[model samples]
Target chain A: MPAGPTERPTIGVALKWVDLRPEVDPLTGAIHDDLHSFGCSEADRAALEWALRLAESWPGGDVDGERAEPPDVVVVTAGPAEADALVRDALAAGATRGVLVDVAPDAPSPEVAALLTGVLEGADLVCCGDYSVDRGSGSVPAFLAAGLGAVQALGLVHLEREPSGTLRVTRRLDHGRREVLAVQAPAVLSFEGASAELRRAGLAAVLSARDIAIDVVPAIAGRVARTQVTRRAPYRPRSRSLRPPAADLDVRGRVLSLTGALVERTPPRTIRADAAEAANLVIDQLRTWGYLE
Target chain B: MTEPRTPDFDVIVVGSGPAGASAALVLARAGKRVCLLERGPFPGSKNMYGGVVYGRILDTLIPRWWEEAPIQRWVTRRGTVIMTEQQSLTIDYRTTAWGEAPYNGATTFRPDFDSWLAGHATDAGAVLVTSTTATGLLRDGAGRVTGVRTDRPDGDLSASLVIACDGVNSFLAKEAGLYPHAVPENFTLGAKEVLALPRDEIDKRFGLTGHEGADFEIVGCTRGIAGGGFVYTNLDSIAVGVVLSVTQLATAKVRPEELIADLKRHPMVAPWVEGADLKEYSAHLIPEAGYDMMPTLAADGMLIAGDAAAMCLAAGIWLEGVNFAIGSGKAAGEAALEALVTGDVTAEGLAGYRSRLDDSFVLADHKRLRRVPELLMSERMQTQYPQLMCNLVEGMFTVTNPTPKKGVVALGWQELRRAKVKIRHLLRDLWTSVRTFG
Candidate 1:
């Protein structure tokens, strides 16, 4: 069926920023915690690029990890705070505008697709990674085409506007099958991972953007907040209901049996001391074992 | 009714710990604005104590608390053991006066006891906010203590008076300047471990019938440090711990965990707890330096109660302070009530708190027993004396082979003379103890 033309459309990207991880000085080994934690995500990363104008992150209450907060364009990548940072930088640099939202922990397929479809807003150009390292779920753009509304193009490498005022996009699919699509404006486009078209903001920008507060308005939902109940009582570990034939077994066998048979639910062990003591002991042990510098 | 999550009231007591929940009970019954704060997952969350309860002060507040409190057992027996280089000759007193209802002394897990007191305060209409901590104090202009600020967002609330009822090393008190300096060296730092055993085994081991418990007070097990050990019997567990001076500990270069571990490893101290699983372990500071470390009791708009006021006495014979804490809390509460009624919330208005304390057993005994900690820290008691007394007891009591020794003959007059301990010194120390403790 001579694969459908890849949709190349411009969508808004609102990049919200998160602070960089704190690092220690290598020479003196002194901890440097002075870096201010501004919830600023910049545009520019190792793996991905940001496109489209900024939009608000959906404050929608989460059902799974996916909140209904719409992303203007589904920018998928191997999860990196750097990628999120580039998206924010793109917004500040006036390249695109869209709120950067954390893909929820263990986000489900339907929710991610729905979130993308909502962002698609009928845009055909959706750019995204073919696959990712952290969460291999790369279905946001294609699934948005399937679920929300879009004609998705797989493995989009480049997205640009033509002199004739139409959008163009290129994709690779089906064992060296390369294709291009000329689509209209307002299309959903996802970029491939490692396509760093977005640039990192320099110090002057980071310091300025820090004062600009990004509001985190949680989307209110009535869904059950906690899916599991963990009751720690007397904080003492109890015997698991599943006993190994009430006898001896290898650790792997015990783990396998516990996972499979579900016979004895192993109770959580109680910690008799405070977190500091336990943490200090583990750190000390690691140092003693020559594991920690 | 799930307690219907009662209105956090004028006072929501967070902890049933002495200073905290005690304020709630005293003021609630008196009909004042108060709240008790506790961060224990429950009433006794993170609560543990050695079981030498001083009751005379407590009886005035709870009135027959020994009758109703969840005490493991009344202490009809007390065992004091002085160690030799190898063995210990012990002295025990089993007075029937202790076995009666309204026990003179009882062993308690602070969680249960503190919770019960919190409940009493609640019954008097103070709401208790469990699993909550007063992270900060709510203060106003001129540096007056107005209320407590908690860890929760928008957790700020106001009161006319904020009593620093928290506890030893109270963050709130220190922040409020109730205690500006670090707790001193004579302060007792106690670390306790609870070992669970079968109730039957516990009863047999402690030589108790059903519902009876024994407390063993120990000296010298602190490994030449200036502190002592205690073993209190519980329902199905044993509370064994050591209370020592932090300064002396630092001077001896003794790590507390090692000190406690060594204490548990002692031959005489181990059998009762041996093989029993350790359930809970915690450490707390007890105000023990006595007399000199007291902070100003009343501030512009606040009062210091419990350990905040440094009310503990580490006297050798009778070591106590919880009830004094409660009493001081009650006195503070009453003074607060009067201040609130009179619409006077200034430092001068709170002056009554100091006088109220002076009138009560809290300051009275603290002032009276000022010499106890001194006597306990005396150089003579730390050396020579305990050994001499233990040697005298052994000589008077021990027998060898077929020949039995008469008490006076076994005492060995020749050796006594050679020991260089004159009768005058004995007379002098007795006079000293009488003047100090009596």
Candidate 2:
């Protein structure tokens, strides 16, 4: 972290590269013959967008009536050489620089986390998606927070830095509830899909980003593996039986019957006969779902 | 000749379709600084075509291109089929020549083909900027086009020359006063679907071995509307679609998608694509107005090529556009080079562009088939001719018990009568067809 008011803070974004297979493939389990291009995972895009947004609103720790300068945004990812495209995309999405951690495609989660920890050492705040779209392990942010000894917030929808240097975050909870928390610097926040959509990368930025030099660092050894893939299977679509209108019914009867069947499938359970009864029903349902406890 | 560099690039090519990419490839290979701008995320992400790439212009650019390009199949069999609701008449010709080296034609999916072609341009040292729309043309004080104004921030890119290869509705050409707003009658709406099947299954169904494929062009399946249907085989997929006259489609009051669905259910077409799964569905506007709707090819510091200049040929027997685009693009490239060498990048200097195209097969073919669009889009050709042909073929093949067979000419006349076609109109159409096609 920088110390002076003129010094800009560093915001780190962890990215994951994915192989995007074409949407069309034969049902005979044959490999897709279409070309595959490199793309960043959706969750990683959301986190990067959030990091860029937060950097724009950074207060700069200024107390002398000077306008606040934006923070420097840096993106870090670990993968093979092809992952350079992902880092370039992040730069086009408004990152100041990029760090590519050289690793294999099958690098374990713990090893990736350790490499990311080394790259994000001096950053004031580090952000990542809740999980990779390809591998929904939902554990990288936790592992990274533990390795960095920083406070971790998962599923954040909103984040901003206060003038006093504390980070305010809003996490979406179940049943339309939100949890807001304020923490000190050097924290890790994992974003959910509820955050704002990523900005469209401009062509100029994309062309310029192609020229930015990506710092490639070799991976560190001695990390225990946490997971292993054992099996591979092609997607099998579930067969659904067709439910047509009854042959004996008229058109009006068929329409009415379909509507009645839909209503019966999800019948409303509670009837608000009175205020007291409604309150009792709510409380009983909450207790039954274990939310009351 | 060389001069002091004043602009950002020597040439700026708008759009990355065949024309733009080919121009960029030629210019960049000649050691000129060029920029290829595309409005899509990538080159082919926004481009669509019916599925056939006819002609050998590509061979001159990238020799034996099919060996490395994403070519789906080389067409070995091709013909047209005239269809009535329940009957059909096909005139197909197949040969081993088309499958050998220097093939006649080939089929490809645009998404794969366009990107690969653009890649060649980039490999030859052209800077390809995707997702950047050229909003307007930059003009100097004397009203000469100097560059393009894109949709990017501070995206005013200046160049000595600008080539507008943008597709049918080219904003740059329209802004430069080269093309007028297109009318509905001058355009055609094409909708296509990619149906995926197993490679072996496709090979077995189409009776093809190795990379051989077939192309079928169908008529009289548009429900009396002015259009036609087509089916082209890919490696493991079939591109089936229809091209309709926009003017007729609007009054026909039928959805284009429904028209394709009805085409898929045709008795003759259903068996070919029965069990295939739909992979992708797309639609695009094609500039079908042959030589009549062509825009001004070149002006001061500006040259228009490809569909933006209405270089597509939508004649009856030969429906082609990509080849013409590539041909015109090569001519434009050569002309631009000449203009650059003489240090006179102006309308008078670039006049060689039109002359080069006139000297090539692009202009000659379009000029010869200038009346085909009018003939193909006529009410009689769309309905009566196909109905008459199908009826005559049906009559010739059917043998009724205890009845004598009529002569071929008599049967044709009887079918023509049944289709409510007058002999005078038939004679006139035949004369026009012969004169126009020959």
Candidate 3:
């Protein structure tokens, strides 16, 4: 691992190189066979190929597709213990440094940090997607900040590396408005949709990735000193399209927002309903599904 | 039809109405490659629900479908009546078989029904492209319709044969010069409104139980014009409309919407639609000019089906158009596919389209009722006869209620003389009907 930087924040990103789903073949009931769909038009296939090329142009990341080289950055991913051998092989193959983010789906927050801290004790930086595609909760990275006792920025959109080994960051806020902030080299940053276009790895990069492996350890998150109880139902497919805030939500002005805007009400308004009670319902539901503290 | 998307497509059907979709569904189920194009955003968005669909023909397409399809109800009550100034002499029929699994008849919302059919086509590997209208036949110099040109970019698609299932006022028909314009006043325009109500409330108001529905056809209500009004029961709403001759509506300068509003306000009509919310109100033109409106079916390159061929029969009593649309669409599909296999999409290859139609009663029904259109225009139906009915029925019920009025058990001649309905006009009108309808 690289020596701890006295002034620069170093970070690692998490990704799962998931393949196309295997369930697609069951449309005709022969579920376990090698099946390929040929129903698409030629033009549509051309469009997908073009999107892949755009994904390969990014300047950073440990994996290189086509002519792009790795930017001295390592992507942290975890699955079964069998993947440990792959991680060891990658570190042995010319990768001098690594940062492990506790990414196990059902891992306790404290347990995740315990494992990550042991592996990344020397690193001064961590990078995370603002919102994971599956969850989009916009949480985990902030929680990591509390667990690891690091200064964290939860709204990271743009980032650049300078010659002096400093990292520049930008954040999204107030409906198309943005802010630039910097912290001396060793803090956590979150990524959101504001990040530059996602880069897709080509066949050559994927083959090269087989040599990369990551070590996993248990991370122990301390007891939750505070809890927010909120109940929100799962989204329905038909009602997925969300409109902008109605005139009621006065979100048009500037405020250093640390959370999503709250619902607006008429003047002289008072809410009799217990906010904690509503939150408790949500926490209870998540706990029932083994996803809560 | 072998519409070669540069290699293989078992069938390429044009239009997305009942005819095209049904054909595509059948061919696709047999493991054939099918491509169905719709000009509208969806099937039947361009359709006019002018009459009750004949549920029998649909039975052939989707077996016992009322259990699942978005059907209003199975029709149990049907009425055809003539009204006078104060009296209506009505004829009604009540059939219970209409409620059984193999239903005798059912009311349909065309957009819902046709969209469901297009879904079946999709499941059978038929690609349905919506919002794309086929402009004209792309023909080889040898005069075979080799493909079609569409309004979309890069939409020049090749096919072995073309089937025109476009409806009543088909652009393809006129562009091909297959259908001639109807004589003045021969066709009619209909405006309809679907009013929403709860299902249970609709049943109680319409005097039906379970899935029984009603269709009430009116006469003498067009106000001396050559048409009347209709009310058909749907799932949770009532469909009401008036069909009037284009010529009469133009001359009287009365719009169909205004006429329908008047009908809805009628003391009797208003009660049936009470508490119902207005959902959709639209006007559609029907080519009921019949023989005069018939379009040529076969050309060198294509076959015409459905309302595009002017296959609707007004029946003088009411309109029945959807079943014919489905049947003709099926027949055209079968003929088109056969023509593709034989490599003969010529006029001769399509001659089977008409001949088979003759056997299937789609064409036969039109031929049988060929004279009914002209015969419905007897002068008595317009003037002398209606007054006679009003005078006769109203006089039969009306009374001076005075003394010595033949003991009040009689329809006296004195009451008839008071109405100016002379014996000469009534006799001549009666004789004209005997020579025509009798």
Candidate 4:
């Protein structure tokens, strides 16, 4: 892809324009279709900030200690024409170029990935927000990584670039655990939405961005994924099968026995218990509450 | 000598309210590279106003602007009310002419109206950059304003001319030593609440039909706080508020909302605002001294318009600001154009702005009614006159069975004595009024 290491690289950033939040009418309880609330998603903004940081740090390729050209931070998105505001915002925030891929508003993640993969061919690195603010499916990065055959590091909470040209990132896992990884060039990394904030655009940049013509490319036919829902209902907890109490008793006694009202609750009491005894006590309470056999 | 730095824009208009938006609109339409800056997410997100927009100033700018401007309603009825705690007198007038096209005044939310006007500017090729505050003016070594320094990093924008329309608390004007009388005595605080009501309910309550509205200006309602009150109808809401003198309000130790509540509960105002739900509450500083507190209109490479220039016409019976802002802003834009053509953007070259305003209704109206704000806020006018007027009206209307009804002149003299208004003071005030409004 041009001369490697010596030539200027392109850092691609995937952007999504979405409404920050839905506002409900306080009096009527109806959602207002307010267009003013729509703008670039927070996650996408953070990813743009990360991409800009990378480009600034490696202004000239730092590889092999040779002075080379800096990378170009380009922001790309696939959406309707109104999404141009997102590109303009990114450019105002210091992105070198903007590309708006014209596509259907509801295009699936796989289709978007395929379209973006074709356009970002020469990019040495592609950065994206882990999930969009609206749908938040978080599948586009995975799909794009698969399409490009590039190393994928998704859901990164922390990121830094090493002097040796590799990117070190920390991905948050379940139960407060973290997974750290080092990724090389030709990689796709998706950062958590709250990881970083985008810098404010300068007035000169904001004004000049109005004149920068965004590259709008028509979408090519690609494999589109279809989704269907057969049935829909609000979620509810499953009911537990309870053992019934004998009916022959006083009204209060029968009610209390069936509800386990008196048997389950106890006033504040504490005791210095050994670890084994404490374990036994917890298990006994669990069994009494029918949580275990 | 070093070559002069090239300007990034021909004109930089700060604060995209009526004045800035109008200036940018005019400059852009004349094929000038203009930039309009706003400190909100959108042009009008941070703006609020009293109630109505008297848009005759916009006639030449956007011909028949009412058809598509996001107007809530056209005010068809106007009422001037005088009140004393329990007694009230109203002088109400209604006209159908205002309901028709090319109408007089309208009620609209500031956010929608300002954004709509800014949209016109942008549509006409003016670059509107929002969410950026112009922190200060950028001046050359010779003390000529060259541009503005914004809050954003590396946000210094250079321009040939700077038009300061940055509202009443304009720091730019203060920094330029333009506002000589900038003090609490020269400003008023306007606090308002937009109360939601059903559209049909509003129409029924206000005696209006089909995009018609009503506005009521009330006095003797601010509890002698040297201010007044207003209630106006929107399409689906009513804006009710008070304008209090900042200096008096400070020592009064009464929150503005308390005064608004008192007005709402008054016998005259209670019926109109019954069962209304507050949709929004806002407060803003108003430059109310009319022509007296107006700043120096033009400075080196800079011109002031709108509230920044104290262009608001706060005279009694004709409470307006937006129209004056638009008028002054248009004049500023025209003056800038002329200066650019002559290649002299200095204060002397921009002196046409002042003359143009003087020739137009903006300065003429302000100059004519320069003493109105002081006269209106005087102790006698704020407290005693309304009481005397209401008592005199009551004396005229009330039928006395055994006691013969007093003549109108005699009853007025009796009420004047009861209201403690000395004859000499009344005569002096009458003379002042004649000389002022003559």
Candidate 5:
């Protein structure tokens, strides 16, 4: 970690152009055209919001109730020309500057990671969404962490700066559990969907954002692909069994039949067993219902 | 005279509807630096219309526009349908000529059509700035309109000439003192629903094939309301709606949506739109004041066209506004070019815009059928006349074994008597219709 209370961290946010095409048409089962129109992903927006909140809340940045000198926030995205709008949206949402890396749409994850590592040279903290909405691969953050040789925290639900100038993060574990960890500066954080809500871009900010020039850098060459897919398949629907309606019966007859089917007439037997025996019985019943390991 | 300095742009046209886009296309093609401002996220995103485009104004702008643009269908059949509670009378006219090239009119969904026109304007070298609304007019030291102030930061834009193509309720025109705000009587509220159906089903039901379409003007379906109803066919959908006089609708107890619902459930209308799924419901305010409500067309460094100038003709038998807007917009562009060449953008310099409108059918048609609004809004035209017409048709068609079949004239006389209409009243309305419609 760097010296505490002496230096403010520079945060870099990774953004991506998320496709917004409807998955399927319910009425016709026909897929819609996947147009080139794209927008900033929701998870990326959350990460950007997290960075902004951290920078704004830094201590001693303001003097005598004047406007605070917030930490520098930079947004970076690597995609084709269509990603320019997404980068501009980050600028509108209060990012200090934006850097766009022009890369082919089908560039491998390692190439993207390498480009991001170059642009984020001096960034003390790097943040990105845990998974992209389009691919859902959840691998970019890991690749970036490996390339930068930085401490990586994936699926972070909460993040804040500690009093000692170290970074504190809370990772969301399965089954509604959370794990808190403290790490030094120059770390990479991938935020889950539970991160901070983003602030809206006002008209003034949007107009000013239009004037900001985005730095476009070309992609690097001589990158070997680590993975390739040879086959693709859409999600197959599971079969469902539906019981036939009792159309032959009248309303009263159907009601009686439904009541008889739903109600159990057997009486319950009282148990005079010990606590251990009762627990074993309950465990066995739960196992039969597939509710236990 | 002071020398004229070049502004940021040669011309700035506000609102990218038919008028603004048309003006931008012409000015940009003429090699003038043009900037088109639209408040919506895209051109025509905020626009809605009654689904008809008449005349060949678009053809002159974009030769054989239908081949490239997204036209719903060419209107080959048209009719006027008069309805009573249980009966209807129709006067229909169909022509094969209308379904071919150089067509008379076509149907369009405004969102697609307007955006395509704006695209052409951009292709001709116009800068289209969407989501930027002109908040107010910018004036120079001499009190002449010079530019516009938008809602964005540092969004002030200057131009040599400003064309206000804003729709019916034009805040810019009102701000410039060229015209007062329109009263309720000068406007109508139109509620429309676009119901989707299969292309083949729509063609089969409407008796159309290929790219042909139909337009039906309906009366007596409005429950005695002052305005009228309409049903227009598109390729795979139908636009069914009612236009009610704003003043009359305000006094009546029925809501506009309720009126449209009743029209959909009407015996004569329900069969035509059966089994169709509703796709969109929209309502818009139409300028119906005609020639009497037209505002001043030009001023110092400013020109107004389309609904902003009250250029819509809502006269019975001729409901048109888009063609008028296109025509007026073209004239504004040409007149502005003339004024620019002379280096005088004053009110006097732009006076040729008025002459151009006079030369075109926009002003002439409005001037000719200006009284149709009054006639259509009459109580008898809304209720008694349609009822009598439908009753006369039903009476002539109904036959009994014991009773003799009645002639058309005899059935008309008996229906007129039953509807409590005097012969003199009928003759006066007939004479008025002939004079106005002719």
Candidate 6:
């Protein structure tokens, strides 16, 4: 639904706090907080890009048009003081204003959503990354939508502005499927990292935004309790549970059996046949490799 | 023409390395709105130097900096080694005082140290703008530098004063024609590799304990190139590298890494760095011509500091740079502040920068030791002298079994004649050294 001429819609973009390059202690394998270089993550930047696009195409939203009335883009993030730089960068990238919910670095996603919920009131739509690069739980958007009682469209891979001014969003689904939905204002949309590329801010915008004061509000209490990390380990993918080769077989035989080499082996063949038969043989080989049904 | 534009910042300090950071810190502390621009992602991301940093200049800027600074190790042992392919004669000195409070010199990764110093400037109220390259100087119609133009769109920032501390290969200083004598011969390329070892392993191999470190300055290890090699200890690693003359290196077609490899594989050096894993490899250009190649320190509305001003001291016995950089940066900052207060941001007004540097150790040391760089890079110092000294030491230690022992003078003459060094050349170097360093 399009906003009335007098009413300017507001799009809220959720930026995540993450270190672009984190220094790790060689001895302890721990992150050195003082050495962290922070920047906007791809997923969060894509969400902001989606929000900007929404604002650009909205009714009376053309920047160069005579009656320019682009929707307000409010960027919000919840983290410690260092996160203020992230908000400043978003403002430089064309955010109308920025709000930093001052929260602990270890604050849970639900708590961060609760903190953002208070500051992002009356925003017509909220856009968020599918997940952050650091603490990638990706549950804040759902919690925010619940808090605002807004329609939630998660896992958005594509978004377009319809002529009628409603937002048409395509969501990624399991098994390479997509679900297209017509999203109205007052909806929470979460976007994937590849959805859009964020525009670079000129130095003029950066210089101007450097002095604009970002609203830093304290984090409200969350209903969910914080969880402690008692143990840290590198992520290990689950290994395939392969059947053991016959114990009596030789080592080479066992290796070949485990690799399915014996079953896949094909001897070189030479055939004097028509071109059509050779083409059929090539197609059959490709089919055997599962390249075709 | 239009009216002169109001300045965006009181001063624009280009490059946030030690010099720019120091200058910004001083000006910001004086209540000047300073903008510090860095081309790298962070303060020292693009910076690399030979292992140890002599940080005595930080005493005034950061009280008890040793307590909080990101120091890898305190150099408790200092050694100067003369080497041949298979032999080394080391002059090793160890003092516990260097490992204690108010330490002498330390080993640090530049990225950590540079950022830590830049953090102070920002904390003192300077706006640090990283990843912004100042492409050119913004000059007024009257040919006075007003500010800088960056690589970004609408990146023109105006300021009353501009301090170029933009490291070696500083395009800003070159654009301003401050470096009339800049040439490839005036610079040296230093390539370093950091090898990681376990803490206990490093302690055992390098004979270090409790955050103590060792630094070795090796002569005759540059494969006859007019430069030297350095091997210093970090907390859990060792930094081994070589500095080679840029012209000699290019002429010989020898890579800098091969020199590092040769140094690491040297019989004496191999024991210390054996089995260590290569953690990182970095290379940087050092401005080594000393006083002769130093750029004009000040111009209209501008002052050059740090490596951009060629303040590195590459004298043989005292190879130091970071301290000189910090020293010059502090002077530049103070001079800029005075100029701003006096409302004379002209070439003559900023002349105080030169006087301050001359009075301080930055210029005084460079001036006193100006002849040392050329002397050290001479063929006699690079090759013949090292061989003569090594053979002399070898001859002294190996006593004759059947024949009578030769006198020390006879042995010295024998080694000198065998190394093909003339007596007159050695005496000339001796007199030059005594006059310059006496």
**Tens digit of lDDT per residue, candidate 6, span A178-252?**
999998768889999998898877777887788999998976664567787889865566999889999999999
lDDT of each: 0.62, 0.84, 0.63, 0.88, 0.83, 0.89
- In model 2, where do residues sit more than 4 Å from their true spots? A1-8, A19-38, A41-43, A56-71, A80-82, A102-108, A200-204, A218-227, A234-293, B1-5
Better of 2 and 5 by lDDT: 2
Candidate 4 residue lDDT tens string, B1-438: 221478889999999999999999999999999989898888888888887899998998999798789999999999999988998899999999999988989999888899899999999999888889999989888899988989998888888999999999999999999988998899999999888888999998889999999998888999999989999999988999999999999999999999989988998778878998888899999999889899998898899999999999887788998889999999999999999899999999999999999999999999989989989999999999999999999999999989998899999989999999999999998988898877
Candidate 5 Cα errors over 4 Å, as ranges: A1-24, A33-38, A41-284, A287-293, B1-7
* Error at B264, model 3, angstroms: 0.9
Residues B96-122 of candidate 6: C-alpha lDDT, one tens digit per residue: 999998999999988899999999999
Prediction 4 TM-score vs. true? 0.85
For each candidate, report its DockQ versus the true two-chain complex.
Answer: 0.02, 0.33, 0.03, 0.62, 0.19, 0.48
Q: What part of the reference interface contacts, as a 0 to 1 fraction, does candidate 5 reproduce?
A: 0.11
Clashes by residue pair, model 2: none
Residue B299 local lDDT, model 3: 76
lDDT of 1 by residue, B318-424 (tens): 76767777787778777878877787878799888889888877777778878777666654565446666667777766676587666664475544565566777
Estimate candidate 1's RMSD in Å: 17.7
- Give every prediction's interface RMSD: 18.0, 2.8, 15.2, 1.2, 5.2, 1.6
Assess every candidate by TM-score: 0.58, 0.88, 0.60, 0.85, 0.80, 0.86
**What residue pairs clash in candidate 5, if any at all?**
none
Ranking by DockQ: 4, 6, 2, 5, 3, 1
Which of 4 and 5 is the better model by TM-score? 4
